[model samples]
Target chain A: MNLVIVLLIIGLLMIVAGCWCLMRTFHLLKMTIGIEVAMKAVTLFLVLAGRISGKIALSETFVITVMVAEVIVAVVGTGTAVGLFRKYGSMDVRNLKQLKG
Target chain B: MTILSICAHGFIYGPILVVLIYNLFNHEFARKHFFWFAGTGAVWQILAAIGGFTALNQNGQTSYAFGAFWDIRLAGAAFFELNATRFLLLLIVGLVALISVLVAHQTVDFNRSSYTNLLMILVLGMNGMLLVTDLFSLYVFLEVTGLCCFIMIAMFRSRADLEGSFKYLILSELSGIFILTAIAFLMMKTGSLRYADLAGLGQRISAGSGQLEDLLVYAALILLISGFAIKTGVVPFHSWLPDAYQSADTAVSILLSGAVNKVAGVYGLMIVMQLFGDVAPVGPSLAAVGIISIIIGALLAVRQPQYKRVVAYSSVSQMGYILLALSTGTTLGLVAALAHILSHTAFKSTLFTNAAALQEQTGTLELKDLGGLENQMPVTAFTSIIAFLSTAGIPPTAGFWSKILIILALWQAGSPVLAGVALVAGILSSAYLIRLQRTVFFGQTRPELAKVREVRGSVLTAEVLLTVITLGLGLLYPYILLLLHAGGIL
Candidate 1:
């Protein structure tokens, strides 16, 4: 129980930090990394949830599936960032204002 | 398996088969004849959904559960279930996909094979989302759908497309994380993620089982709501919507606005309501969001110069009505929400189809650059007017009936103020749509646009087909109400 609680606090703090990184970063790749960080924290939460509920097997399956999905999202995000980089000659999010209202 | 089960299974397997067969052909042939493959898959889905709905209704089954080559009877196993609501949504998916295919035939010039492949994958993802019986599976399918959308938005790799796609990716992934965290918290509380297990969770939370459990549940609820709100593109979370819609090709935009948002975002919210509705703040919070989205979406829409941006913002506004109806948490509210979703699918697709037509002919979608082409493109003009009428909830159009049903549902749910506000939003909708119409169609024909001609082929067919659906549903809505009354549901 102590271990689970310790992990929970660590996981949540990681998410907050990840979100902070996501908001503070101007580089497109950094945003993707921030998102990945938050996703990993959620993965930890899933494991912790399983530990609390005595359904580690179920949560293990969920964690694996989520990892796969997160990887795909990362790949797509990075690819889009590359495309944006080629278009704008920089990885800066500030250059992404062409479609504004 | 029985025939109805076979039809249900087809929703999952049909798209896969299309992808396989589409790839079997040579690249050149597949590229040239992509429409037949994608179109047939869409039409098959539509027929299957209708068949499944009718068969399930005749047998008096609320839900039909089946596993895709797996054992659903095992403890804690994930599976798919088909019910009336899923059937309705699946039908919309099929219909919007068909419209997107029709528009794609004209608008998507390069990467035709990739377009067909991605579109099928998108349909598969949406079908999976609709069919899943568990929260975890829903999230997986939601990501599948989101990934397909991001890819399709950036398919052409244009500067604008890449920007829009990137913005959508970041926000969508953030929402995904939110949903995952909520799912984790829910699992911590309930020990399972299945719909059956999660039912009455709100009652359990309100039963005051424990302080920690209650806090966890509340946290989960908040996460789920905001996550799905971002997907639904309502109010403050809607910044990505117009950008994505405006930057993508019109065919892709049609799918984004007409179908994907509803299936991915609104449907997820519906599940949230189904699960957590008994909580004290759930319904009112949703109502507040709904009202804000309606007012702000319209206000933003009125200021856009691009044709697709207006329609996109209008989508945000219309989504608010559905949310408001769903927020009522009554049987009538559910029915009204479904009706509005169906009508919105038809009219919104029509408006986007008109966008395709205008873009193809006038070579631009800027309202300022466009002037009177009413005579030049009579079909597109007439269809646009009908769609505008529906958007404004004018008489004898499907939007009018759906909006009325929504107001009635709200009133019956004892929120007369919301009902009245929804009524007034109809006028606001008209104000923007009229301005849109007057600027693009009713004004004097600019010298540059004087020679613009009507769009032919599949685009025109989509326009007429969607217009008929909007009008037909409106005319038939009365009988539908009577049928529900006869069935003792109203």
Candidate 2:
């Protein structure tokens, strides 16, 4: 039953990732958030795979540390998005035409 | 001997400490601090050479391990190895830092104390990168250097600098994320992040069923390489180089082109290749990218009107040669790559400083506005010629030896066609370089440049120092080769 749920989540995440990859007209902030959702789902998928395989989650400490790092990275990414919006008046990476070569 | 060497090792940390004390005391000690950093760097380089020689003489044997308080592991493992190669890399870091400071004293007009401090921190991080054997430690040092690069470039606070720095930071962040993801995968599979620990994992992955292991390793490699490539400004990822180099003040470009790119990008690629010997499978892929960089970079460089942008694009091409040699993985290839690295450092910095002097004196770097610099700034023009010749790979110059060695290595590796391509690239190098010389130094004086006079002593000293090294390498080719071999890079 749990396996079915995990697979469903992964399938949904893949669909979203494809959509994000194709959305060329969206704001950069939105696209970046989409990437974030996909990444998080992938991590969840890893946890589910380990659980399904019955592999012992060795060292809860390491797992906690990784979780913390993931959260920090996500926060940093959001901050970067905000900064980009402020600088260019839009978060669309396509608008960064000053350096296009 | 161990105690003495260990103390000497700690002395490499002296530059940072000096800066810290000076700042706290509000002392006007830029010159003193500069000398302190240079002196300590010289001392460290001498120590590293001695240690490296002794290790080689002893048939590659050395053992020393001090306390490491911040050993964060990906999967609960510790990696601490001291080797001769690490010592040589440390020596390179020290030498480059020392050279940068000497060059800085002449050309840089920014806040002296802060610049020296940041430079020391960057040097410290680079030294740490060379010393650490663990993957996590590698990442830590990588972040340190990357942050330093961002801060240094954005230090000017110009709109162009900010935009360029922002772009660089974002790209680097993306790459960093991928690297972390790869590290996570490795930890999940092998339960350890120590490089030696990964050796067993590598074997298991290699011998495993299907190409899953191959895909995973390549994914990690791709992430790391892409990140470092962005740092180094290799082609297809070189948009940041010209903007950053052109907009930056003089000292920043010198460090960016000469040191930052090498440490943060090329160093990472070399480390990954050395760690995993299975790079042969992807060797062709790397070679393809390198060839494209060589062709595109040189062609684009010829079309740039700005002097600095031309040098910037040429760096992209020169670094491609470095990447190509690494891809070959032959002894001769490795030797040539290292030789090129050293020679490029000398000549490229000379070019940058001389270009800066021209910019300052004439208030422009546009080739259309410059002419007959040889008669007015004889010293600058002379050094510029030597640097240009060295980079053009003229015979009996350092660049020539390195290029020939790389070609020989490619031939040894059974890629005569690639070697021929490399030769063609060499001709392209000569074409663009000759054009630069004719336009800047040999032509009749431009009306606008009539008021230009030679820059004074210190700037001239810096260029002369670097140009001397560029010329000396050719005359001392055999000894340099021996040094490379002894350095365990060959």
Candidate 3:
């Protein structure tokens, strides 16, 4: 029980850090790193929660899927960032405001 | 494996296979054979429609079963089940998917075979999303669809397109994370991630167990709503919508406005919430967002110079009607929502195709630059009129019928204010749409537009076919009502 609580706290900390990276960071690469961290947190929670409920396999599958999704999202996001860099030569979020309402 | 289930699998995977086989060849070969994918999709829709129609005639099956398909247990925990309305929803999506790809072929400049490949992936994702019964697998499919759409948007590799794709990617990623977190909470609380498990719990609660006082479930529910609302482009959560629509290719716009957002946002929410009850727990808040989208989209669309952006905002507004119907929490309301979805998908897609044709000929999509095109491009003019009138809920159009039902549902459900506001928005829509119609197609022909000729091939066919179908449904409104009633929607 104590181990589960400790794991949950670590997961929560990672979640906060991941969100901070996404919400506050301006660099696209850093933003991706933030998402990756959050994904790791989700992975931890899934496995620990599974262990708590005696469904480790189910949680592990979830972890695997999340990792796969994270990879795809990261790869695609990097490709997009490269394209943006080619077009505008910047990785800043504020620079992507051309479509004014 | 039963023969029938194998055949059912063909309906989902057959078009995907066809598209993949074509892509294995050179780009020129794939470009020439884009319609083959459409052909496969049409065949699938016809078969599904026939099956659904037969089921309707038989009053449909009452049992909801999953855990296996053709004696195949998915190693993954994902499962499949049918709602009373599944076949109908599938049939509608199949039609939209077919037309959307056909329109996309006409609109996009083919740079590679992968363009068609991405579209096939999108259709597969949407099919899985609508059909999959497990919440986790459903989210997987949703992300697949979202990823495909993101990639497709950036296919043109233009600065505007890239920016639009990037914004859309970030927002969609955020929504995805929210959905994942929500599902995790639900899974933890319930010890199962299947829809059946959640539905069973909800059933017990409704059957005199107790009022749902669980904070985790409530938190999960709110997160799910927020995630899908951002996806659906409802007001306040709709910042990326117009940018993506205006910047993406015309065919992509049709796919996005007509099908993807509807499926990912509205239908996604509906399916998840169905486990709880007919009227979802978040109905009131969703309805509030829907109303805000309607008025704000209408007001903003009227002032836009770009025709695509105009249509894009109008899409946000039209979706409001569907969402309002959904929030009413009655079978009649569901029927209204489905009906509106069909009409909107039909006319809105046709309108976007017409917009594409205009841009193709005029080299401009700005409203101010277009005038008196009817004399030159009569098919586009005539069909666009039908399309916009249908959008504005004018009589004898399917939009008219669906809007009436939605308004009636609201009033009968004791929200006369919303009914009145929706009725007034109908007039507001006509005002702007008529303004656009007159500016673009009526009055004196601009000197440049006078030489423009109507597109004489597949583009015209797609537009006319969708417009004709919308008009036909309106003309045969009674038959649709009878069919829905037969299908147990009423």
TM-score of chain A of each: 0.93, 0.63, 0.90
Per-candidate TM equals 0.98, 0.82, 0.91
Chain B alone vs. reference chain B, TM-score for every model? 0.98, 0.89, 0.91
lDDT of 2 by residue, B1-490 (tens): 4543454355345546655755664445554465565446545554665655475447545644433444435444444445545555566666566656665666556556667667777777776676666676676677677667666766665556655665665556555555555665555565555677766444566534665434556666666667667777889888778877876767778878887788777777777666664654446766776788888899998988888888999999998988888788666776667778888888888888888789778888888888888788888888888888888888677888888778877888899998899988988887778888788888788776777888875567678778788888888997866776697654
The better candidate by lDDT, 2 or 3, is 3
TM-score of 1: 0.98
Of the pair 2 and 3, which is ahead by DockQ? 3
Candidate 3 residues A26-98, lDDT tens each?
Answer: 8877777777787787777667657766777887888888788889999888888889888878888888876
lDDT of 1 by residue, B1-490 (tens): 7778999899999999999989999998999999999999999999999999999988999999998888889987888999999999999999999999999999999989999999999999999999998999999999999999999999899999999999999899999999999999999899999999999987677535656666888988999999999999998899899999999999999899888999999999999999888888889999999999999999999999899999999999999999999999998999999999999999999999999999998899988899888889998889999999999999899999999999999999999999999999888898899999999989789998888989999999999999999999999999999987897767
Candidate 3 regions exceeding 4 Å error are A1-13, B1-7, B52-77, B82-84, B200-213, B278-281, B482-490
lDDT of 1 at B489: 65
Model 2, stretches more than 4 Å misplaced? Answer: A1-101, B1-4, B27-82, B200-202, B206-215, B480-490
- Alpha-carbon error at B202 in model 3, in Å? 4.6
lDDT of 1 at B70: 84
User: What TM-score quantifies how close candidate 2 is to the native fold?
Assistant: 0.82
**DockQ for the candidates, in order:** 0.91, 0.18, 0.56
Candidate 2 residue pairs in clash (backbone atoms < 3 Å): none
